[model samples]
Target: MKITTLTNPRQTILLTSRAGNKDNVMTLDWHTPLSFEPMMYAVSIAKARYSLELVRSSKVFVVNFMSCQFEKEVLYCGRHSGKYIDKFKETSLEREEAETINCPRIKQALGYLECQVQEELEVGDHILFVARVSKAELREKGKRLFHLFADKFTTTEE
Candidate 1:
């Protein structure tokens, strides 16, 4: 077993970013709340990821906390790249304008955090974007998707 899988059952999210007319969404589990006073967050993206470029250039993103039912769509976004195809058009997920950031948010998300990038640090193979939660919304309540391993998942106990 890969050591990385030790961090199993992590809550997954869809990160949205837009640069110019291009909007992108990517599946992410590597995120954390940094501070409560300022409402800060951090998400690590691979250096080669297409979404990283969008978030970097735009300095904004939306963290879409997805429901467990959207696992298929989440996996699709993770497998494909926005550079080669339009993820929003391909998936059943609907794109909606975020309240604070320029990026779009998923209409089906349980909640979302509109973030404005405050800093970027290169961490090994990933770039960690530290952002301030400019706005947040809880659209719905449901079991959230959790990634255990490739093609394997779990959900919060209801």
Candidate 2:
């Protein structure tokens, strides 16, 4: 069985976090809503990823729902890394303070959920971070980007 086939054509999201002076955003496709009552959200990030380290130290992250307009920015963040460059500056994505967390959310996002880390576990090559949503914000609705496996991404409006 191919892992690519298993995780194909998934809705993508932007995961943001901050550690000290370092803030970063990364394209995430392995995320889901776990519960409604407690407003739980989970994201599976590779342990070796830079964003994972920031999230681990900060214990907070913002899940930004990007519109189709941000497909280029998403690919840039996913392709590069925060270790060598400032993603916010490089991508020119505006960062705004999260409601209940120290991290920042993408200002251009259609919606966002600010989360505080509740639990984490090492699952295979990735670390599953389950967080409780402390606050959320939604602006004018728009089409969202969905990764269609490989280098392909389509918009929700399509």
lDDT against the true structure, each candidate: 0.93, 0.90
| Poorest stretch of ten by lDDT in candidate 1 | 1-10
Candidate 1 at 124: error in angstroms? 0.5
Model 2: per-residue Cα lDDT over 30-141, one tens digit each: 9999999889999999978999989999999999998888888999999888999999999869999987889888999989999999999999999999999999778878
Q: Please give each candidate's TM-score.
A: 0.97, 0.96
TM-score of 2: 0.96
Worst 10 residues of 2 by lDDT: 149-158
Among the numbered candidates, top TM-score falls to 1
Candidate with best lDDT:
1
Estimate, for each residue in 47-145, the C-alpha lDDT of model 1 and write its tens digit.
989999999999999999999999999999999999999999999999999977678999999999999999999999999999999998887779999
Error of 1 at 113 (Å): 0.4
Off by over 4 Å in 1: 1-3
Which residue pairs show backbone clashes in model 2? none
